[model samples]
Target chain A: MTPQTDRRLQPRRFLLLTLFLAGALLFGLVAGHEWASPARLARAFANSGGHDMTSQLLVVWRLPRVLAAAMVGALLGVGGAIFQGVFRNPLAEPYLLGASGGAAIGATIALLVPLGLPGGPVLAALSFLGAWGATWLVLGAAGLQGRPDTAGLLLAGVAVAAMLGAVRSFLMLALSDDTVNLQVVLSWTLGGVQTPDAGGLAILALLTAGALAVSLPLARGLDLLGLGDDQAFAFGLDPARFERRAVLVGAAVVAAAVAFGGLVAFVGLIAPHIGRWLIGPRHRALLPASALIGAALVAVCDGVARAALPPAEIPLGLVTALIGGPFFLILLMRRLRA
Target chain B: MIAVDCASVSVGRKGTSLLRDISFRLNGAGFVGVLGPNGAGKSTLLRVLAGLRAPDAGEARWNGLATPRWPARKRAAFCGYLPQQFAPAWDYEAGDIIALGAGRASAGDASPGHVLARFGLTALARRRWSMLSGGERARVMLAATLATSPALVLADEPGASLDVRHKLDLLRRLRSASTSSLVVAVMHDLDLALRFCDRILLLEEGALVADCSPDDLLAGDALDRVFGLRLQKVRRHDDHDWVIGLG
Candidate 1:
């Protein structure tokens, strides 16, 4: 809001973010089970049917994985921004608020219990339910409807997530003993980008687009919500009704992101904060910035995870946690100091 | 055009009431000051009348329609509320906050620049809210409150943090605004309310104790008893009165 920040910050922000994302994309395309040159990667990306082994490897596996990472990251980032904006709480994110846990539970159910539905819709629907349920439980427990309490919400989120984690574990165990396979549990727990499938990647992309389409219009109303509930009502928005719609959108986005790649932690948390700190705090700028920055963040993390060890690979969630935990701590310290 | 009929607001069903069967009606533009001590349900009344809160018992009516039943957007277009406490969770420039009043939601035509200039605050538009002084921030918010040029302006303690000069300036502006719009404000300053307000609603213990002209309030026993202080008119001038309170 300073005069120093006016007119100069926005374009520069997009420029820097674009450069950052390009670098991450190149790094993502290049570093994998086998190293491909950036040029070869680009060629493979442009021409999907590359006959050579390295080109095929880049085209088939690496490209979809990287794009999926970017898509999931964008969803999480925008989801986090929406929650933070509507709730007016800096710490509001899917992972911290237990929405991810809810989605995990729903996804595990879809994997274990055969509803005869296809993998995509079942996963999306149940995960959406889980996410929305967990978010509402947190809000109700934290008493967010009546007052602003960061500490209360944080505690409530922790408690609900812990409870949901227990449920997820029990379901996973029962499924492992009965008929369901164990690999899905491992991937969901480790939270990594699996070998990419083109159709799944396409679905992730579409869902990301749909969530963003719904969220963009909610910006001005969310801005009015930053004013107190009574004041928001005076300004023609019912705070409770508007919050339900926004929370539903945010939960849906987070559920879709998690369904793609288990539970990628802190892309949501880190991307939105960076956008808010570096750029202005308006939702219009922050939402897109958060998505782009989040895409870049996850792409870089996946690149680092694969490239860090030669034959042995680190989990994407662990790397993100290693980076995001410290970042969250620093943010917490700053907020406490303020 | 604005009225509350036997309206009541309470905490829980069969719980302690915040407002106890308050009833009044206003037909035209006037500056009505709601004067009370702390926790006298002054803000609660303002919220009900502004259509922000529906009463548990009766109704807050605008042009005869019940507020809670009215479509929310329509009510917003009619009533403008200025809260006693405005906590902005984000960092925004003064102009940005003012612009919120006119765009996207309400079909208000009075632009932010015009409202800012009306308060003689065109300079503070671009400044960070953190950089502005308390008085300057309050004025900016006041401009935002009036940006829509709402028919009924319900302000809760609009000048609670202002100095003498700023308080007088704010009151004068509100007085002028009242020529076209009904302006109701919760006031703590008895002298200013007496000098500037056309009518006064005296509230005490979750009840409307008196509804009368400001001069009648100054001459009445309710003012002395409700506020738990001796309030007197020391000297009278044509334009204003020299009133003081001794507690």
Candidate 2:
């Protein structure tokens, strides 16, 4: 008989994760070009409303940026975990599965076309459509019969991402003469927290909240799916319906994240894997844990992106990719070796 | 009670029939063995009967309502389905995987814990999917299937990959399940089927060639005709006999 996985150390791990998230949030709040001293932040926190310049900067600039980063990170993280579960592949994530690719294309189209008639930002709306459309296309193409074959789905995701990348590149080149527009689009393509306006942030928050609410309850269904379609069916869940619902929620969350920043490459992939390592693979604990870790990872990355070169910020996506690309390689090597 | 009323299933570009107008009704708890040659559509019939697939024509019903009409959870609560080959790819703990079968905390006395204990798998709960031996995985799958206390247990070749000891162990579990739940298994072992099954369903080319007790089936020479082999019964004991197949 195989020995049980050790459970005694999980509480300590959870504690460390929580502390890391808090520390990351603090770093995002204080570590900018004009560093807000820990004493100043504490005084501001105690005062709530003050006539100080530091307090106003905290309210007007820092708070929204930090909040936006956390929400977007959580969205990608949770989206990644769900995609991994639905696809039954460790490498599956929102960016790799065509959700963010679709979102990026949609956001770019909105930028180029200038659809002014909208209750919400045209960019956000189009990105949502793009996200849902691309993810669904992958699923439908992989297999519309019931559950998708993992290899086929992964290949389809890669194909969709590649085709969409070509379209995005053409659109970006079209704006080469418009250097300002090109710069903005370029930042987004590389994936980073652009830190939206209040309205944009509100929409992102709403989308993130709604997607997470739906995903947590379906954890058990995801667990069943790891076995395969036939076995999940025998266990009572309509595996097809489960896959569709997972796509619907996952796509929406990914779109909201990508709409703000661009591709935001590795948060989804990195967060869920780390979450699984920290907590076991049961989606119940794993999903929430992934969301927390994702929020922390992006917040810290965004902080570093801003603080790295005081006057000039590094692209957040570039930073994540630097970390994520190697992480992906290690995982691949391990899988091959095994 | 479970009944398949003129259920037909066809597939492929040529519309080849997999199960052809098969009909049968089985009531209460008893072991029913489905026997067939290669390409006889035993697996197809099992899928149709399990309501995992909708038949091209007619219906498979539990009680009076068509099983397809039942919500997936209700179907899961009522039926246990075991495929010929099923092994989870993820590294979920064996206990967590088995708990996936329980629609409620306890289905009569058939909770995940109870089923695991019954299979002497209480110590194996912590084992991950990768860590399990084939025999252990087989037993774990069986435990998960039975955890819901299903009214109907449908097994497709449950004994396909085990050694003699594990095969007998699996057979005994199925036999016990049949005491309270109807067990329908796609079986290849003629000797085991004759010894354990109360009834046998012999299919030839997607047709129900024989539906009878072991004696009636043997006396009628249906096995001889279907398998294209001579069946000779040799005396072993007063209550048991050894059946041999020869050209």
Candidate 3:
């Protein structure tokens, strides 16, 4: 639908914008290399029988990073939308609920002690478990009275996150002398989407899909919940039950994203808001729009991370925050005017 | 016709009673105005009647069924409640908000367009709630409540922030709506309540002080005692009764 005639396709516009964004990022990724040129790309595609060094680098290096970035971004974007809708607070995100903190602490401890398993997968597993533990603890604290307490859950998340932060600090100081262990911990926690192998990519894909499956069905409930618990109840919804389900879905998404790309921030928070601003607050359109926007944001950040500095890669989280922060300000200003 | 029976219901919280041993039986169609001083359990009584809150003692029943026994979805179909302090978090269109209430009603509820037209809110159907004036917002909310075509409507402070014209219009619509449904509203304006309500329930410190017609209530000293004021009659016409408060 054309923008002149229809607003129903407002979200479609945002999705199309994301596609264009992805195309630009792919162009940058393929052509940004000093040795790589249009002639090389054309030759690589034209000559199918013999493999060249350029084609090998394209397949082995660039493709994995792009796919991981898109997957992780979709997870974060969807998770952020669920969290904000469930909490009925625009500032709410997966990280705000302590999932990332728990994952970071778990990954740190796993790195310090050799788990006798393959390093990446073991760390990912522990991180996932840590995030799950945090979610349960938060829900338990909120459910002390048999009924789920929204305010209590938020408070509990803050306390748990602070405690986990302290524990992580203590561990870092304890291993200050061992530069190798410290470097591993810092690299894992400080944010970067490492190029994953085929198996790792498959696991990430499964986890993200599972999170989406849980979240999409509850979109209507989330809209009701946004009106507040009492209003939602009056409208024939079980607010506490919906809140529990939404939180679990958000936590699962956060866990999966953190395991793959350590502590990437703002993609979850910014993407949903952008989606809402582009479209309305309806979750049906908001969910997919946010997911696409998130995927594009992260994919572009990864492209810049790799290609901007030649061989010296910038951290994914830094790139996102630096750009997302200014973008958020502009959105806020526009909202105030409207 | 629906029958509401509050069998000695009492609600207390934090060692303070909000409603104490209140009993009432209402049947068929009429407009009921619940009047009370500040913190006199007007909203609490509505909540208890709507089945959102359970009383500490006794029970609220609709027909022969206990309020708590009715499934929420079913209860929502026949019972429309407009809370005292409600502000929608999202800035939805007026028509959309009405549709949300329409969905809470039983299937084949009145269309949002029809309800909005009845409430004189058709012009503002496309306007977002955030852009509406306070009076317009109140009207939109009332439209939403009425769109459900509920058998029983419990509205708290439906005319809280409206001008005199809107307030009178709201009471008139509520009065007419009672021809097909039981309408109970909590009001602070005594004159409006007296002029519009078919019956009045006066509450004082969580106790039912008086339950009668407006004429009977005006003739008694109970209102003076309950309201802590000396109410004086200024004038009375065949269609209107004017009372002035000499505090």
Candidate 4:
């Protein structure tokens, strides 16, 4: 097909794909339970005055978890796109940058610290600071004379993440005698949607939306930035300033996602690749498309996690990596060949 | 007319000089070629002139205003620079690349299509820059530089990877372009510089050894001293005077 014709059809295909994924997720919300038939749902809705167990189960527990998964996934996806743009490396993601590991460190510190603070906001703030700190450290270690060394940055992030992971393990070990639920902490580390309450999910949605607002306006600059720092400067951007802004915004999104949904792996990396395949590399379209794809990916993955192993719930991170890893390899192989 | 004045510009670290005590003044429209041996700081001098580097000792001024002091947007508006290497992170179309070089003037600026057509790159407008041949990519990059429509253009070895025909065509185009803007190009081809450029600057060991007309450059022994080579000069009545190096 002609490039013009291909371009015209891509948006339509993306729209159809989005609609189909939304339909599937909506169906998934009602499909898993044995008692969740259309008639039973209608009856539960009709008799929804007080103590309707099935309705509460469907509306209260499942709905929020699925939506939370989607929001967190969207956060990760957009963050990945920003990281790729700012760092000019296709392999860049918050998880790889130790943002997730940093968030875990922050959350553990918040829980185990003597501040006696409230749960949600304090945890989020700590996680945000932690994510930002870790990213800055990685950038600093990998930067030479104010310019990022891409390979060094990735390697440094990995080394720092490993160190942070060890710290987290130590924190967990130290807290074992303090009556903290090791199971919960383990699940969070392995990455699972904790089924946040409506208020918590609402706060997550707000934070993610706010981060996206700050980032969407930077789309054009990000596109120019992807051409490397020197090239971006020559093309009329202040590369150092723009890079910091993008990296900070992306870290915020990742921190918020980690605070809410734990360290869901690979969504950020894979979703943008999928989005780039659906649309081109222009950040204006790529960001939103990646978000949509990530939302669907997480929702579907959560649904599978719910239904796949029945009562023994598998963590979302395992499922994402299990699926995203091989798929990414295939895509990478294709790209390398091309 | 654009005036580029460099005053004792020196750049490097650890008390070593990559470009040392370089000074020159140019005004009006003309093509000037910078010639030097390897490690003689041709690229460094070009970067200094393009305002991509800050000299340790002195400054470069454009129209009497220090280049580093000019606001980035203002500097970009008046000066267009093309680096020796083009490593774009994205596979942008040739047209989009040029449009980016046009800056925020997308509303009323010269369309990228027009620029591509001018560079004989209309057919490659939709092609991904990474997929293009070396010569085609060079043309696209030069087209982006031209699209900025600056009063001064700084290019580093633009014709390095091009063939004989394309190199000659590129030099001819730059020669014509110099009628409206000052073009400074770093070149290894002394013959091409002599044929197309009005003036030449020869450097040795990070210092300017000669800054004179192309005829004067050929008439002197600076080339032999700087490059350690002898040149055979052929003067013609057709104004196509050329000089080539012999061992």
Ranking by lDDT: 2, 1, 4, 3
- State each model's CA lDDT, in order: 0.80, 0.81, 0.77, 0.79
* DockQ (Cα-based) for each candidate: 0.70, 0.67, 0.46, 0.55
Best prediction by TM-score: 1
For model 2, the stretches where C-alpha displacement exceeds 4 angstroms are: A1-13, A30-60, A119-121, A144-151, A173-181, A197-203, A336-338, B1-13, B104-111
* Residues B98-200 of candidate 4: C-alpha lDDT, one tens digit per residue: 7777653443556776777777888887787767887788778777777867788888986787899888877777788899999999998887878878889
Residue A232 in model 1: lDDT: 73
CAPRI grade, predicted model 2: medium
Candidate closer to the true structure by lDDT (higher is better), 2 or 3? 2
Model 1 lDDT tens row, B193-231: 888789999989778899999878877789889989887
**Candidate 4 runs further than 4 Å off:** A1-10, A30-52, A144-151, A176-182, A328-338, B104-107, B117-122
Residue B129 deviation, candidate 1, in Å? 2.5
Off by over 4 Å in 3: A1-7, A11-15, A24-28, A31-50, A106-129, A132-160, A171-185, A326-338, B105-123, B234-238
Q: How well is candidate 1 docked (DockQ)?
A: 0.70
lDDT of 2 by residue, A200-279 (tens): 78877887778778889889888888878888888878888888888877787787788766789879999989888777
The total number of steric clashes, by the backbone 3 Å criterion, in model 1 comes to 0
| lDDT digits (tens) for residues A1-338 of candidate 3 | 21121246674687676776677456544633343565665566566422877776666666677788888888889988987787665655566567788888878877776668788777767777777788667656655332334456567877888888788889888756776878767766667788889988898888777777778887877777766666677777777677777776677678778878887877888888877766667687778777877877888787777667776777877888788767656654664465
Those runs of model 1 whose alpha carbons end farther than 4 Å from true positions after fitting are A1-9, A42-49, A178-180, B1-14, B104-108, B117-120, B236-239
Q: Against the hidden true structure, what lDDT does model 3 obtain?
A: 0.77
TM-score of chain A of 4: 0.88
Worst 10-residue lDDT window, candidate 2 chain A: A1-10
- CAPRI category for model 1: medium
